[model samples]
Target: MLEQRGILVPEAVRGRITRRMDPHVMRDWFRRAFAAAAAGQVFGDE
Candidate 1:
């Protein structure tokens, strides 16, 4: 989704996401990606 919008996902962030193992959290991030302008927005600040 970010790629479709031309937003680049940094390699470090990609690595972090790659290590993420929770399906619920991944689902939430996937939904949020549609509205996020940045990678940080997907996971929020929590």
Candidate 2:
């Protein structure tokens, strides 16, 4: 069963966050910003 395999553990495999508190999007933005900065593009200041 899934429980025996730990596949049904109480872990967050998917989530929905508020627009203002979307950590996944924020992380992606940070990644893109860092990449842009590294490539000498104009990313906004922190």
TM-score per candidate: 0.80, 0.34
Please provide, for model 1 over 1-46, each residue's C-alpha lDDT reduced to its tens digit, 9 standing for 90 to 100: 7778887888887887889999988888889899999988886553
Among residues 3 or more apart in sequence or in different chains, the pairs in candidate 1 whose N, CA or C atoms overlap within 3 Å are none
- Per-model C-alpha RMSD: 1.4, 13.4
Q: Which portions of model 2 show Cα errors greater than 4 Å? A: 1-19, 37-46
How many pairs of residues in model 2 come into backbone collision?
0
Worst 10 residues of 1 by lDDT: 37-46
lDDT (0-100) at residue 37 of candidate 2?
23
Q: Candidate 1: RMSD over Cα atoms?
A: 1.4
